[model samples]
Target chain A: MLSIKNLHANIEGKEILKGINLEVNAGEVHAIMGPNGSGKSSLASVLAGRENYEVTEGEVWLDGKNLLDMKPEERAREGVFLAFQYPVEIPGVSNINFLRTALSEIRIHRNLPPLSAKEFLKMTKEKQELVEFEAKLANRSLNQGFSGGEKKRNEVFQLAMLDPKLSILDETDSGLDIDALRIVSNGINKLRSADNAFVLITHYQRLLEYIVPDFVHVLYNGQIVRSGTKELALELEEKGYDWLKEELQGQESINTK
Target chain B: MMEKDDMMLDELANKEYEFGFVTDIDMDISEVGLNEDTVRFISAKKNEPQWLLDWRMKGFKAFQKQEMPQWQNFKMPDIDFQSISYYAAPKKQAKYASLDEVDPELLRTFEKLGIPMSEQKQLAGVAVDVVFDSVSVSTTYKEHLNEMGIIFCSISEAVKNHPELVQKYLGTVVPHTDNTFASLNTAVFSDGSFVYIPKGVRCPMELSTYFRINAENTGQFERTLIIADEDSYVSYLEGCTAPMRDENQLHAAVVELIALKGAEIKYSTVQNWYPGDKDGKGGIFNFVTKRGACRGDHSKISWTQVETGSAITWKYPSLILQGDHSSGEFYSVAVTNNMQIADTGTKIHHIGANTKSRIISKGISAGRGQNSYRGLVQMGSKAKNARNFTQCDSLLIGDQCGAHTFPYIESKNNTATIEHEATTSKIGEDQVFYLNQRGIDAEQAIALIVNGYAKEVLNQLPMEFAVEAQKLLSLTLEGSVG
Candidate 1:
């Protein structure tokens, strides 16, 4: 459902994502694994159309439409969801009200009727149950004074609410405990459908254990150098990225000779 | 997104004031100038008794000696008192027994202001006293209130009909010699609402007054008095609007409230006097003095206001807690946009032991507007174990706008517990982007943020006033974001 070809991006004149090429069909799960500074999160940010990142060269297509031409809000309305690594704390804005506004905006963009107050509340309750979010947390300001686990759970709850076709979870499991990880993964698993896709950007193999990926790619130096099945994650966990770096150096020297 | 947001803000900046149209009606305007003769003319026009005329002469004498205040940060142009007309009222008879007797054009003016003076469209459960320029034209629900032994009528009507009540508590809370504006207001104050609730009785409905300024170059000086007798309760609200003009008009008003033992009084105000055009050419210079006195034990007084319009606003609504265990509260949300200036706050005086007071003030400044909060909390020596809590917050939308806070506190007894909290914040571009990313437009985002900032004060308003206040806030802060 999503395709990216040779995506070149930078921030402040420094290139971050040198060249990224990826394609994912419906019902497929792609896990992008890399170490710090390997551009995994940068790819997610570029795909989400963050203003700070300048797309130097490339094209990204979502449902046969050019994604780079849209604003961040337009991208959001067009079903591109990014679960921020650090959710913003919007003081004084109730969680429910913000979600309702967002839902209405999306509905208007899609030419659908706005949900009634009762229907909105019911949907919110259902989504809250699906993500196991606390009831009181939904009434307070958006993510204000929320615990780390609760913030992640709120992101998942929002994902359930929006029902986006492409959801890029950026390190959502970083600060989550084992129980939170299980709940988030179970929520995502329940949301996965044949018409949608998931791009899991994570640094550790721990998350893939609960929500298994169909394909695992090792992103090194802003490029995906190794691609394999789910077993590749176990191999990487057994042997860290140093061996991969050494193997890449050996291959570069051989090519030079 | 930033460009789109900027464009939207541009459109909002040029939005016209919808209530700026003037009603073409003949008026009974006073001769230009301020003097004893002018005050006497106003008194003669009202057919006042000798004591009331003498009181006006005293106010005029006091006003001549007092000087205009200069302590506020706002700069004021020298006002030519001689150039302003002291009184202007619609051409009508002295007394109207019913609505049909009132002038049709005057009724149309009220209708244009969205305040239907006609009986069929009058607001239910709320009695309104409509003040047109210098005189009260109509008062609704008078007989119903009278049946309950509650007196709600124009100040002139009260002086003629209920002389004893009017003489007993006219200026008890705010005397004519209190301030320059209060003195001037007393000297030629034409008409306003007067309410009196009997002992142990609760006012059945809300009491309201709508003040409108129609005549050019006329100064509106209206006085309001509300007294809740022992063990009584009442809720009073005031609103005002004016026509657009090229030269600034003056509106100096005085409001006094008194609550006796075991009584409670709640006062809410939504002041929407015409704020000048975008260039700040002409608007109302609203200088007001409003104060309440808690005279008996366990009495309470609360002031809630939403001020969003005016070229320059200078007002401080205060409360004197003279009774033991009496409580006073002030909740205000002041918004200034496009060169509007507002310097407003409240004063709380704890005179009796175990008294309590609370103040919550929110100020928003945008588009070169200047907003300030100046407050004072005083505890006398005999105010043993008194307590006070104050919270002041200011929000600025654009860099050109200004927000200020000045709080003065005096405590004579060590047992007084006073706490104060203040915060200042800006609506930054990143905050806007954060909301934009959630599919909310910039205008909606700004309005939401502002409403959230002023939620505490807005929550204190009555239901009808709350909705109107919300709308006024959005209108005032529109296009303020950069």
Candidate 2:
């Protein structure tokens, strides 16, 4: 469903994502784990068409369409969803109103008729229950004065409402407590289907323990160094990333000689 | 990406003014110039009584001695009084008995303005007094209102039919000598609406006035006076629009509202006059003086205005709380796009004990527009335990626009309590991007954010006007992002 070939990106004239290559079929979950500055978030931003990140090289294809040529809004309409690391707080815009606008715009872009008010409320209520989001928060200003746990839950709620083809969770579990992590994971687990895909970008294996991935890839210095199964996450969690850093340094020395 | 955003801002700022069509109608236009004769000419044209003429003559003398104000935030343009025709009215001077007697062309003009008189009568439950150029052409539901001892008619008609009431409250709230513009309006004012609600009666419908500036080179100086008697309540609304012209048109007017004992009055305005082209070549220079006086104990007055047009706007709708326990409220949303400049706010004076006032102002600036909110809240020595609360917020879209706030508070009584809050913020790029990532375009995103920012003020408007104000805000700042 998604393909990225030799993707290179830069921010402020400094390379961030250096020649990233990845591919995933439908119904697959991929986890990219790395150290602090391995460009995990940068990869998500580039795929979501953030304006500041200049893609200097590479092509990204989503289902057959060139994703890089589209605007951020167009990319969203093409079913690319990025759960931001820090969700913006927009005061005065009701969360329900924002969701309605997004849903209508996406539906219009896909040549689908808009949902009636009754149907929309029903869907909202059902999704709110599915994510266990407080009903009162749905009518309040968009994410204003929300707690860290509530914000992550709102993101999952939006993910459920938008029903995107490919979802990228960028550090979704970084600020969550154990309970919030379990709830968010439960929402994502229930939302998983054969027609959708997920990419979990995290620094620790804590989130992986909740929603185990089919493939785990170790990212180092803007490149994927190793690919393995779920057991690899436990191994890296116990050993730490220092061993991987030393191994990469040894490989560089050998190449120079 | 920045260049692309800039291009979109330029396109949004350069959008054409929608209400800029000239209405072709014969007009009785006065010769250019302002002098003693001009005042006498207007007074004699209206066939005013001797006392009224004397009052105008006094106003003219006051205007002659006063100088143009210098303390406004924006630079004032030099206006040549002699070059502007003081009065212009439709040739059909007689009042229309019904919609059938009104000219088709004039009706079409109002039709284009979205307020067809024939339809308005049946649809909005709003009694409209249609003021074309300078004269009141038709007043709907006057007879219906008269059944309840309510007097709703043109000011000129009121002068002839109800002289005592007109003379008693004409300048009671905003005297002619208050300022240069007020003096000028009092001296050469043509015609506007005059509403009087009798004691103990609640007005059944909204009273409205639609002012259209169609005649070229003419200044619209209309005067409005509304008096709510003891135990009465009334809500009044006014809307103004002008055609496109290469030369600036002056609109200097005065509005006076009086609330007697146990009375309440709510006045709302949606001013959408022509704001000129992107280069700011020509538009209306709106200088208005609107004031309401709570004359008796327990009276209340509220002012809600959405000002989205005019190249240069200098207005401050004020309140004088002279009655003990009286309250005043002002809610305004001022939007300036392209090269427009607006400096507007409110003033509340607490003269009696335990008076109260509240002010909420929101200013939005886009393109090269500059918006300023200047407000004053004064508590007199006798105003013991008086209270005032003010909130001023400014939102800027695009890097070229500007927003400013100036608030003045004076409290002479130690028992008085006053609180003021102010904030200035730019439309965050991240906010727009976040919305865009959810499938909403940048234009829609900006509009959503702005409408939300101004929601507090917009909620104060009447239902029908609130919808229009929301649409106007979106249209004024469409796609304008920094």
Candidate 3:
């Protein structure tokens, strides 16, 4: 459902994500783990088509569409959703109104009929229950004064409403408590289908315990250097990444000799 | 005076007029001149009584000799009084006994501006008096108000029927010699609203006036007076929108109010006059003086205004707290867009002890517009324990526009306590980025921020007027963002 080839990216003239390649098919969860400034979040941002990130060399496709050329809203309408690490706070604009406008814009892009007020409200309630979000927050201003956990749950709730083909979760577990992480993971697990995919970006293995990943990839510097089964995350959790770095140095010396 | 002299000496000083337009309406306009004879001509044409004519003559005398005051934030061109037509009315008899008699040209003009006229004009409610140029063409729901002993009618008709009431409160709050504009309005004011609420009566509906300017080169000097007797309550709203015109129209208006013991009056104004183009050429030079006096204990007067038009606007709707425990409040949101210049604020004079006053003003300037908030809060020696709170905020949409605040505070007694707060900022690109990420466009984003900034004042307007004000802000902000 999504593919990236030699993704080279930079921000403000500093190289970040370099020569990164990955592929995730439907019904699969891929967790990309790395240390600080290791391009884990940069890969997610580049995939989501956020501006200000200069792509020197890259190719990213979502559902067979060129994601790099599309505008942010166009990418969103094409079923590519990015759950931002830091969601924007739009004061005075109600959350429901914002979601409805987004939903309508997507519907118009796909030639689907717009949802009426009744249908929209009913769907919103179902999503709130599924994501365990505070129902009262829907009518308030978008993300204004929202707690950390509430913001994460709202992202999942929106995920449920849009039913996107691919959702890149960027540090979704950063500020959430144990229960909130479980709720967000469960919401993602329930929304999982053979026709959809998710690229979970995080440094910890705790989230994988709930939404079990199909594969694990370790991002180092600017590229994916290691790919293994879900067991690899548990291994990294126990031994840490120093062993991998030591092994890489040994391999480089052997190759030089 | 120094500023005036500078403006006069600047040879390249050319004020561009943007909205120079004249709708296709049959008009009966007086020749251009400023004198007692011109006042008599207007009074005689309106069939005014002998006392009213004599009063107009007195106002004219005051207007002719009175020098225009300086010390203002705005710069006015030397007005050729000889070049201004004093009177102009729709050919349709300036009087309408019923809605059915309303002129088609007037209705079409309102439709062009998207002003709802009937009950459905607003979903919440609409009780409007549609005025054309210098006359009240039609007033809605007057009979019901009359049943409750509330007298709401055109000033000219009031002088004819309720002579005693008109003679009693006409200039009681602001006299004929109050200021330059007030003196002029008092001199040749052709028509406007006159409202009287009897003792112990509550007005049944919200009273509103929609002023339309359909003539070219004609100054609309309309006077409005509202009096609430002992134990009475009333809310009055006035708004105006003129079609684009090139020649500058002079509108110097005076509104006076008198509140007896235990009475309350709330006045709201949403003035969207035709503002000039970016170069500042042709538009209305609005000079207005409005004042309300709380004559008895426990009386209250509140003024809420949203000003978004006029090439040059100079007005201060003031209140005189004359009785013990009397209260006065002013809430204002002034938006000057597209070379519009607005110099406005309020004056709260505490004459009685223990009086209170509050002032809140929000000014937004966009597209080379110059907006200023000038206000005063003064306390008399006997006004012991007088309290005043003033807050002023300005938001600039672009670097070219300017926003200013000048507040004058005076206290004679040590017991008088006053506090002031002011802030200024521009609508930065970061704010727009956040809103746009949520799928809202730039225009909608600016409008939302502006409305939020002006929420306190917008809340004072009737729901319909509030919506219209929002739309006005949006249109005014269009092409204003860099």
Candidate 4:
């Protein structure tokens, strides 16, 4: 469903992601577990078409379309969804109205009739039951006065609404309690399908226990050091990332000799 | 959307006010001058008493001796009073006792101006008194209000029927010799609405007046006085839209609001007077003197205005907090576009102990327009524990436009607290880019952001009127603001 060849990205003239090549097939969940400052969020932002990042050398193809050439909104219409690590707070704009506008814009781009208000409300009520969400929060301004836990849950709620083909959950468990962590993981698990995929980016393995991924790639120094199964995340959680640094140093010494 | 529009001064000539056209009604006009004779002519025509005529004569003399005011951010050719016909009333075919009896042509004129007197009563959820050219043609909901002990009618009628009430409060807030324009309006002011809410009664409905200047070269000097007796309350709204004219038409009116002990008065205006073409050819020179006095303890007065579509607007809706524990407030949104200039603000005087005042002003300027807010807040010696807060913000759309704020605070009381804040910035391009990334077109994004900026003021309007006014604001700046 997605392919990237030597994707090099930087922000503010500082290189972050260097020569990142990855591929994800349908029905496969890929987990990118990395240490701090491992260029994990930068990779997600660049793929989401955030304007600040400059892709110095790379090509990204999503289902045969040039994903890098599209604007953020166009990428959104083409089913590239990034559950932001920190959602922007837009004051004086209701959550429901913003969601409806986004939905209508995507529908218009795809030559579909705008969803009727009744249908939209019905869908909202259906998805709202996943987390037993309080409906009052929907009427408030977007992300304003929301707790850290509530903001993360609301991002998942938006993800459920948009139902993107390829989803990237960036640090979705950074600021969640155990219960909220379970709820967010369950919400993502229910949405996963053979035609859809998710990239769960996290620093700890605690979230991996709930939303177990098919594969985990260790990212260190802006490069994937080792690719392995779910056991890799548990191994890093046990010993720490210094073992990976030692492993990368040993590999570089071998290549030089 | 359309590749960014460059500044187009070529279409300036074509942007003349489409509604600035002179009507063909035969007018019984005063002679082409203003003097003691003109004052007497007006007082006599209205059958004024001797004392009233003396007051008019005094005001006429004051107006003659006084020079035009030069203490503001406005410049205009000296007003030739001799060139303006002071009193220009429509020649009625006959006296009409009912709304239908009045000329549909005249009512249709109001209709074309979007101020149907009948509908403003029936549809707009308010009573409307239409002052066309000079005379109050009709007043709606007067009888209904009278049942509630509310005397709502025209000023001229008030002088005839409620003589004592009119005489007692007419110039109490805004005196005849207050200024040049006030003196002129006091001398020959033809007609305006008057409301008197009796003690202990709340006005059941909003009272409104629609002023239209239709005749050519006619100066509209209307006087409106509203008196709320002890413990009474009333909300009044002033709305106006004028026909397009080439020469600058003088509109010097006076409105006085008096709220007795424990009384409250709220006045609002959506003034869309005729603004000239883009190059500023002709429009309404609206120099109005509107002031309110809280004469009794616990009284309150508030003024909220949305002023746009004027060539040169020079008015300050002010309040005098004279009673103990009284309150004053001014909330305004003034927009100047296409060579329009507005020097508008408010003044509050805290004369009694425990008085409070608040002022919030938002100014938007575009296309060579100039807008300014000049305000004053005073805490007198007797005003112990007085407080005031003011916030003035400006949004500049075109680089050539100007936005300014001048706030004057005077505090002699030791226990007074006053805070003022202001900010100025043009609509940034990065904001537009962000909204565009969210799938909104440029215009939609601009509308959303501008509406958000003006949310505080728009929320003060009634629900239905707020929706219409929001749509009007967008329509007024459809092609230009972004």
Candidate 5:
């Protein structure tokens, strides 16, 4: 459902994603694990068509359409969703109102009629219950004065409302407590289907235990250096990334010699 | 990204004014220049009484002695008084006996302005007094209003039919010597609405007036007066619009309101005059003075305004709380876009014990527009245990716009309490990006954010006016983004 080939991106004249190559089919769950400054979030940003990141050399495709040529709003209309790590707090803009505008615009772009108010409210109620989000929080200003956990939950709730084909969760579990982690993971699990895919970008292996992934890739220095199954996450948690760095250094020295 | 944002701002700055079409009917326009003869000409044309004529003469002398004040925040445009005609009206001066006798062309003009003057098509439960140029063409539902002891008609008619009421209340709130604009307005003001509610009566319908300026090179000076007698209640609204012209037109108006013992008056205005072109070559120079006085104990007065047009706007709707236990409130939402400049706010003077007041102002500036909020809150020595609260907020769109605040507060009574809060913020690019990622376009996003920001003040308007105000707010900032 998504493809990236030799993706090279930069921000402010400094290269971030050197050469990222990845492919994922529908219904598959992919977990990208990396340390700080390893381009995990950069990949998510590039796929979402953030304007600040300049794509020096790359080709990204979603459903056979070139993603890099589209604006951020067009990408969103084309079924690409990025759950932000830090959700913006827009004071005075109610959560329900914002969602209605977004849903209507996306539907119009897809040649479909907008949902009626009753239908929208029904859908909102169901989704709020699915994500275990507080009913009061759903009616307040977008994310103003919300707790960190509530923000993460709101992102999950939005993912359910938009129903994008492919959703990239960027550190959705960072500030969540154990209960919030379980609720969010359960929501994502319920949303999984044979027609959709999920890419989980996280720094810890703990998130993988709740929403188990079919493939786990370790991204180091802007490229994926290791690929394995769920067992790889446990191994990394036990031994850490130092062993992998040492092995890469030894390989570089041999190649130089 | 920055270049794209700049391009959007340019597109927003160039949005054309919609109500810029002139009515093609013949008009009776006065000759240019403002001297004693011009004032006499207007008063003689209205067939005023000797006392009224003397009052106009006094106002003219005062206007001659005063120069334009220099304390405003904007660069005051040079106005040549001799170049502007003082009055203009439709050619047919005979009073129409009914809607059928009114000219079709004049009816069509009001129809184009979304105000149908015909009895069948007029807005329900609202009486409108239509002022075309410098004369009142028709006042809807006057006979019905008269049945309830409420007098709603043109100010000129009030001067002839109800001279006692007109003479007693005229200039009582905003005197002719108040300021330069007030003085000029008092001298040459042609026609406006006059409303009065009798004692212990509640006006059954909303009273409204629609003012239209269609003649070129003519200045529109209108006077409006409203009075609520003892134990009465009334709500009044006014709207203004003018045609497009290459040369700027002047609109100096005076509005006075009075609330007697146990009475309440609620006044609202949606000012949407022509705002010139993208280059700011022409528009209306709106200088207005509006004030209300709580004359007796336990009276209340509130002013709610949404000002979205005019190239230069200078007005401050103020209140004087002279009656014990009286209250005053001001709520305003002023928007300036495409080289428009607006300097507006309100004043509250507490003179009686236990008086209270509240002020809320929201200013939005876009596309090189400059908006300033200047307000005064004064507590007199006799004001015991009085309280006042004020909140002023400004929102800026695009990089070239500006927002400023000038607040003056004086408290001579130790028992008085005053609280003030102010904030200035720019529309965040991050906020726009977040909305974009949700599939909402930039224009709709900015409109949503702005309407949300000004919700507090917009909520104070009546239901029908609130919807129009929201649409005007959105249209004023259609393509603006940060």
Candidate 6:
């Protein structure tokens, strides 16, 4: 469902994602693990079409469309969703209204009829239940005064509402408590389907316990150095990225020789 | 969505003033100058009685002693008062018996401005008084207003017919010597709406006045007076537009409202004077003095205004709570875009015991526009247990725009409770990106954010106007951001 070839991205002329390559098929969950500044979030931002991250060399294809050529909104309409790690607080815009506008825009792109207010409301209620988002939060300004947990849950609620084809969860468990982590993971688990895929980007192996991934890739020095099954996450949790750093150093020295 | 948003923004950025076309009707315009002769000419043209003419002379004298104000945040080129034509009225019969007798060109002007003036197409349950340049051209729903003993007519007509009512309330709330602009407006004011709701009577319909500036190089100085007698209620709305001109025109209007014991008065204004082109070469300098006096116990007055135009706007709609337990409220949304400048707010004087006031102001600045909120809240020594709550919020769309807030709160009584809160926010790239990531374009994103910012004040406008004000807000800020 998604492909990234030699993804080289930069910010302020400093390269971040250097020679990164990845791919994911339908119905598969892929976990990209990395330490601080490993370009995990940068990769997500590049895929989402953030203007600041200039893609020096890359090709990102979603389904059959060239994703790199699309605008941020176009990427969204093409079913590429990025759950921002730090959600923007947009006061005065109600969550319900924002969701409705997004849904309408997506529907227009698909050449489908717009949802009526009643149908939209019903859909919102159902999604709210799925994500366990508080009902009152829907009427307030979009994440204006929402707590950290509420914001994350709201992002999941949006994911459910949008139902994107390829969902990239960028550190969705970074600031979650035990209960919030459970709720967020439960919501993601429920959203898992046979036709869609998810890219779980995280630093800790804790989230892998809830939404187990079919493949785990360790990203170091802007490159995915290793790939294995779910057992790789358990091994990393027991050791840490320190072992991975040493392994990369050994491989670099051998290549130079 | 991206292309469509850009197109809409381009259209709004280059939107021409739809009401810029001038009617071909002959005008009775005064010579270019300001003096005793100019004031007398205006009064004489209106056929004012001796007392009113004397009032004009007093105002003229007072204006001579006052220098132009210099304390505002906006910059202004020195106004050439001597070169401005003080009065310009459409040459027609003093009183039109019906719509048929009015000039077709003048009627077409109204139609183009979307002002429903004909009785058949008039807004239901609303009385409209149309003021063209400096004269009241036609007043609709007069017979309906007369049946309820509600005297709604031109101020000049009020002076001739309801002289007692006019004399009692004229300049009562805003005196001729109030300020430089106030005195100037009083001295050469031509004509505006006059509304009087009798005691114990609620007005049968909303009272509205549409003021249009047509003649070039002429200053529109209109005087409006509305009196809500004891135990009465009335909602008055005023709208303004002007023809496009290269040289900046002056509009110094004075509106005085009086609410007697147990009465309530609601005054709303949607000021859309031309804001000049993108370079801000020509437009209107709107210097208005509007004040409401709650003269009897328990009287209430509210001022709601949406200011989106005018190259230079210096206005303060004030409320004087002179009666015990009186209340005053001011809700305003001011948008300045593309080199426009606006310094507007409200003044609340709590002079009576237990009086209260609430002020909500939203200032949105875009492009190189500058917006400022200068408000004054005073609690007198005798105003025991008075309360005032003020909230001022500003939204800056781009780095070039500016927003300023100057709040003056003076409480002589220790028992008064005054609270003021202010916030300044920018339309950050992240906010726009977030909306875009949700499939909403930048234009709609900014519009949504701005509308949310101004929702509190927009909610205060009357129903029909709220919709128009919302659209105007979007129109004013379109293409303001890159």
Our model 4 lands, by Cα RMSD against the true structure, at 5.6
Model 3 iRMS (Å) reads 7.2
Q: Over the stretch B32-110, how does candidate 5's per-residue lDDT look in tens digits? A: 9999999999998889999999999889999999899899998889999899999887898747888788888777777
DockQ of each: 0.46, 0.78, 0.16, 0.17, 0.70, 0.48
lDDT for residue A61 in candidate 5, whole number 0-100: 95
TM-score-based ranking? 2, 5, 6, 1, 3, 4
Better of 1 and 6 by DockQ: 6
Which wins on DockQ, candidate 4 or candidate 5?
Answer: 5
Q: Which stretches of candidate 2 lie over 4 Å from their true place?
A: B97-101, B120-123
Per-prediction TM-score: 0.92, 0.97, 0.86, 0.78, 0.96, 0.93
lDDT of 2 by residue, B1-482 (tens): 67977898778867888877888889898899999899899988889999899989889999999999999998999999889999787888758777888888888888888885775465668888888888888888887899999999989999999999998888878887999999999899999989999999999998988898888889999899999999999999898778888899999989999999999999999998899889988999999999999999999999999999999999999999999999999999999988999999999999999999999999999989999999999999999999999999999887888999999999899999999999998888889999998999988998899989998988888888788888888877876883
Clashing pairs in 2: none
By summed lDDT, which 10 consecutive residues of candidate 3 chain B come out lowest?
B4-13
lDDT of 3 by residue, B1-482 (tens): 23322332231123332233456877888988877778889988888889888877777778777887878876667888888888887777755665567777667777776656775643444567777888777777777777888899998889989999999888778888777778888888978999999999988677888886777778888899899999999999898888777678888888998999999999989888877655677778888888999999999999999888888888899999998999999999888876788899999999998999999999999767788999999999999999999999999876667998999998898999999999887776555544444444555667777776787788888777788887777666664542
Give candidate 2's TM-score.
0.97
Clashing pairs in 1: none
Candidate 5 runs further than 4 Å off: B94-112, B116-124
What fraction of the correct interface contacts does each predicted structure contain?
0.46, 0.80, 0.12, 0.17, 0.66, 0.76
Candidate 4: what's its TM-score on chain B?
0.94
- Residues B125-150, candidate 4: write the lDDT tens digits: 68877778777777777778889889
DockQ of 6: 0.48
Model 4, position B321: C-alpha lDDT score: 94
TM-score pick, better of 1 and 3: 1
Q: In model 2 chain B, which range of ten residues has the least summed lDDT? A: B115-124
- Cα miss at A236, model 6 (Å)? 2.6
RMSD of each: 2.9, 1.7, 5.9, 5.6, 2.0, 3.2
Point to the candidate with the largest DockQ.
Answer: 2
